[model samples]
Target: MPIINLNGPKLSTAKKKELVKRFTEVASEVIELPEEAIIVEINEMPPENVGVGGELLSEKEDK
Candidate 1:
């Protein structure tokens, strides 16, 4: 089984579905694996939980 892990900000259900479909399609094509055998796992986090350049993402948005 091939697992595709994606970690990033949260998204709407529609966007998540699109990402999973697209990722699975491409990965299956390139890796020669069945679409059903490819797994796409998404990990979403709030902006407050993420930091960039020593500043939290939520703080940056407020700036």
Candidate 2:
């Protein structure tokens, strides 16, 4: 069994499952692990959780 932790921006529920499926499919080929045995954890973060160019990734500018 493989445990994969994925972190990224907010995603829809369907998209989340799609990501898991895709990850599982691609990883299973190389790791020799069953798709069912793979565990994927998606950690969706709000814009504020990320930053860029010395600024928070909010909807508005930091300055």
TM-score of 2: 0.79
Task: Score candidate 2 by lDDT.
Answer: 0.85
Span of 10 residues, lowest total lDDT, candidate 1: 1-10
Query: What tens-digit string does per-residue lDDT give for candidate 2 at 23-44?
Result: 9998898898788889999998
Tens digits of per-residue lDDT for model 1, 1-63? 799999899899999999999999999999998999999999998999999999999999998
Q: Pick the candidate with the highest lDDT.
A: 1
Candidate 2's displacement at residue 63, Å, is 9.8
The regions of model 2 sitting more than 4 angstroms off are 59-63
Name the lDDT value of residue 50 in candidate 2: 78
lDDT of each model, Cα atoms only? 0.95, 0.85
For model 2, how big is the CA root-mean-square deviation?
Answer: 2.4
